[model samples]
Target: MPKQNSIAITGAGIAGLSLAIRLRQTGHSVQIFEARPREASGEGAFLTLAPNGINALRALGLAERVSSLGIPTTGIEILNAAGRRLALLDEREAQRQAGAASITLRRADLLEALRQTASAQGVDIRYDHALIDIERKADGVTLRFGNGESAHAHWLAGCDGVWSRTRRLALPASPEPLYTGLTGTGGFLDCPHVPSSGGVLRLMFGESAFFGYIKAQEGPVFWFDSFTLDEETAIGRPDPAALAARTRAQHAGDAAPVRDIAAAVTSVPRAYPVFDMGHLPRWFDDRVVLLGDAAHAVSPHAGQGASMAIEDAVVLAACLTAYGAPSRAFRAYETLRRDRVEHIVRISRRRGAKKQAKGPVALFLRDLLLPLLLPFDAKTTQAVQRYRADLDPLVLPAA
Candidate 1:
């Protein structure tokens, strides 16, 4: 029998939970620590899971479970602020290529699904145990939490998000997440007035702001808007009502459908500033490693953040299964993921720059060039959605 290695995972977000499930399946013992209470895990805005994300979930036997709970979007329509059609990118071909369709669901729902699956597999998840400090030892690593508890593991993986404490502790000189100068505000609307969009995601490039919405087959519409703001104005959080009002004012007279969606929002819209991390020289140190947003955080413009994290989890698990030493496994995992993640980060930043165009010339150039660039954009989507994780050989032994 092989020796069972115990691993500690920080941050019970998508990356951590997915890694826990994958590691357990690979015959490793896993423990997950979450800074936030378990109840707060399910609170967040909606996110799209592309075909690549679906493929990763399928590797864990979770594709169908998540698909049953999310709305499938088959296409996207790019429009001008005046509601004029710009271009349409149908995802049917991409879906066929990847063996799964794209889905959009609340962040909480996905996290809950991951949590339940991990818990069912006997992964210990400790909530409110925020990681504060770490001490590397010869045989393993010692972790200290904010609650004054300590634990040692053969290896530690940091799956924390953009503002990761683990990354800070592991790489004291690592770059901080950089603000993209854009703020996003969005919410659900029960009474959307747009024509049935055939379950296609609608993206409107407004004169001054960008708006996106999708109407589920039998549910309320999900919508969001993004616009550029100065660093001073974008630093502090804004009230939900005030944010909604600001969104409406920004998009007023641009597109009727967007306006209708904004007016229909009854819930106080949630707001967040977009941020992404630049490339780091290293992602691992000795027995400690970083995963997901802790290593590379792409702006939402790419729609691949969650998917990328899922990919990281599967690949890291496979590396651990293949290599006897934790350090070697961490090196292999970083080598496999760094280039791909960094490329996506660059692509996402470019997309975000276009969406946050402020000057009239910049907006005009974007509007004029976007339609002509649809073909290239379709190719980009294919590249992002067609990734498949090699997970067969790493599946856990039957109990």
Candidate 2:
């Protein structure tokens, strides 16, 4: 494909691949450069795709294929370490709120499916080509990869994620992502002995940490947890075995299966610090623009990371296709997404705060107040699930 007809994207994660498919189907030459190997496995634990996320995937013609790869998640059951029920946020209600319930599946599986779909749709996806720098051009931008290769396109989309090099190279003064002082690790266990969660995810707000798990009808159990990291944490890429032991130690004496599931782990685990950049002064510089996590990195507690990215892909593609000029298109895209994504980011931070380890007094207060506040929380959850990728074809810049 000639440079004149091409658009380059960084990071082949959910946002990049979704954007590639959207652009390619509209006759643009799209290419994605991913830093990871072709395998693209060993990603984080499972993720639950909410209804709004499904709507975005539907816009890209991927809802059917992606949902086929995942099991429907009915709801999340909240509990205290003392084994007391807090509340059940039923996803079945999502049908009325957003026309569908959430689906739960391994994060890696979703990424792989998107990658294959993009490739099949004639999008050039080059793995191990981590982006390093970008040089401005008269008509477009030049992307430099760490592999010593270069590509030029009429415009660039930085779907690269929170620490996006495209954002760093393009917007030098942009604020850095602030660590939420929380880090976590999680993995799956193929244990059938553990009692089923009865179609809902059982989330234990353990005395020392938080853990969540759900057993497939007759399959394996999907689980994960959230824990804080010590300032200047010295965890230096511990392997699976080491990570598992540490997780078990952190969650010791929580409850049944908190320890049991930790022992039966066979899935690849993820360990990292969580960060959210809900606010960014800008999202584009000339022909270079940011999308998805690159623009608004929210914590996974919000359950909107993938959904928001897919939403960004749809809106960004629509703006570029409709507005033609990058300047006008980028402005329109930012106007449409900034408020919503930032709001979700703030909500995610609040959700994360609720799970942090608390003292006995705080714990008592939480247990006492959670039930009273349950009704309001449910309304918020329903609203989050009700959002849609309802982009108007003729977008006017936000006043």
Candidate 3:
């Protein structure tokens, strides 16, 4: 364990809470500041937890809770517009290599698990407290929150969302998030028509859009359709039903599962344009640092956002534990994580391009060739999933 220090983490999302839990366990005092007033109770759409993420959670000792909520994958079946099986992913081989199966669950379930673990670990979570500013001195950092409160700590870490206040303060000249020419409109639907032994997750690629649905427990499965939008086409926050209708109109092809899923969604769908920014020159300045989406907000196309966040949380805590002092820990974190995170960010963009490709020829190639290429692709996937956080690495004492 490292020398104890009072640490303040902004954003009570997956990364922040996980870090808070880990830090407190290793004999550090941790406090989490969240903008939302209390934990989010909204039912989240579906999310897949890759083995690397599962390993991080296992390290945090919440693996059982996560597995309990998870619907295991026998395998992944990729189908075409006519529902013909195009490709199959050998989930068994993947699991054997990683030592754990990829698990899919409602996003809310994962967040609740993180929140409960963090709270149970004695991490003080202060909700409704937005981070406004930070003052980093030679010795420590002082953080000012929106609620007219301030806290001084030996170190501060930002696990805030994509639009991070900490990032703006740390790197004021960084470029804004760039849209990747695709808009993802996602939500859950109670469609019993989609067979659910909880067998295979379905993905359909077409000229105008890509539709995906995953089975979940308790009868509410989730689906997301990614559509290529022109610059003028607005993918803004609107009524879910209205957005579904608009999305249906955008795809003028032989859409079966796509149309059915859209019409089945009773709950409002949420639409967000996918965007990712390249790595900043630095993730830490003195006693302040960034983690998770705050550090690298990769596109969802990579299907590694949650996994990456969980990895970041565990690794950040590990670096701090290994280094002890704020300055040294922050530097080690940047050195170890910057390249990996930046590489994933770029990979995610490429994955999105493959999914958002237009025309029947492009669709046939993506839907057909990509699956056949899984043997090769699995190697890339394993490289991303096999990361091990160096929590117990050697450290030099404070000079």
Candidate 4:
């Protein structure tokens, strides 16, 4: 049997936990370090995992488990500010092609599932051990923690998020995450007046902002709003009540449903400023490499951030299994992922730009062009949704 590799993964997120699970399945010794406490680490809003992401989870024998916890999204309904339907992107055909339906669920649920699975698979996860420094040595890499502790491992994977400490310590020259000038706020509401769409995502392109909602079979309506802001106006965080008021005001004049949904938000809405990292020149240094959001933080407009991270975990593990040597496997992993992730990032940026459309002319052009352009958008969705990581044996013999 081949000698098992000792890998230290920074971040117990979807990427890190999934990577740990896959590595352990392949007989690797893996440990995870997370900055936040285990209980607090799972705090996040809901997200949609496309079919491609589902397929990646399937590789880990987790698709069925995740699907059970999420609502299966069948299609998307695009609407104008006046509640007029613009275009419908049906997922029936895409699901047929992809062999799975896209799913939307709370980010916390998915993280919890990954964490439990990782633990069951014998991954040693330590929370509240934020990585503070990384040093490459002759024999291995040393990881320093903020808790006045340190450890060494033969290989290190930076599955930490956008503001990754590993990325900073390992590749200081890498580009930082750029603020996209769009702020997102969302919350759940039980508005009986708002009819359920039976798992279809309803999205509206308003004059000054964007609104989206979907209904689970039994839960409250899931809704989100995004709008552009000037750098100067995007100062300190707004409290939940203030954010709710701002969101309601932004979409108040758009449509009845928009107003109704905004008013229906009973709980204080949480806010997040959107950010993304563009193409990175490199994703690794020696035995240390970056994964998922640490390597490419895609804008949320494309709704593939988590999916991309899941795909990265599967591909990275397969590469490591094929190559044995950390450097070679990391290079192959980057080669397989960079182009795909970069393309998604570009598409997300374009989508975000359209969502942040301002001025009468831009809004007019968007309303006019969206219907004609939706067919192409559907085609792109097919391509993205049908992606499958090729985890077959590499042509090169294993080292």
Best by lDDT: 4
Model 2 lDDT tens row, 153-270: 9889999888898899999899998888777776567787888777788888886778888887787888887777764662455476666766777667766777677656543344
Model 4 lDDT-worst window of ten: 390-399
Error of 2 at 66 (Å): 1.1
| Backbone clashes under 3 angstroms, per model | 1, 0, 1, 0
Model 3 CA deviation exceeding 4 Å by range: 1-4, 39-44, 216-218, 230-235, 248-256, 364-368, 390-399
Q: For candidate 4, give the lDDT of residue 88.
A: 85
lDDT of each: 0.84, 0.80, 0.74, 0.85
Best by TM-score: 4
- Alpha carbon lDDT at 242, candidate 4: 75
Estimate, for each residue in 63-134, the C-alpha lDDT of model 3 and write its tens digit: 778978878765676666666777767667767677677888878888888888888888888888888888
Clashes of 4: 0
Query: Candidate 4: TM-score?
Result: 0.95
- TM-scores for every predicted model: 0.94, 0.94, 0.90, 0.95
Residues 130-211 of candidate 1 have per-residue lDDT tens digits of 9999888777888999999998888799998999999999998899999998888776777634566676999998877889
Query: Which should have the higher TM-score, number 2 or number 3?
Result: 2
Q: Could you tell me which 10 consecutive residues in candidate 1 have the lowest summed lDDT? A: 390-399
Clashing pairs in 2: none
- Residue pairs with colliding backbones in model 4 are none
What is the Cα root-mean-square deviation between model 2 and the actual structure?
2.5
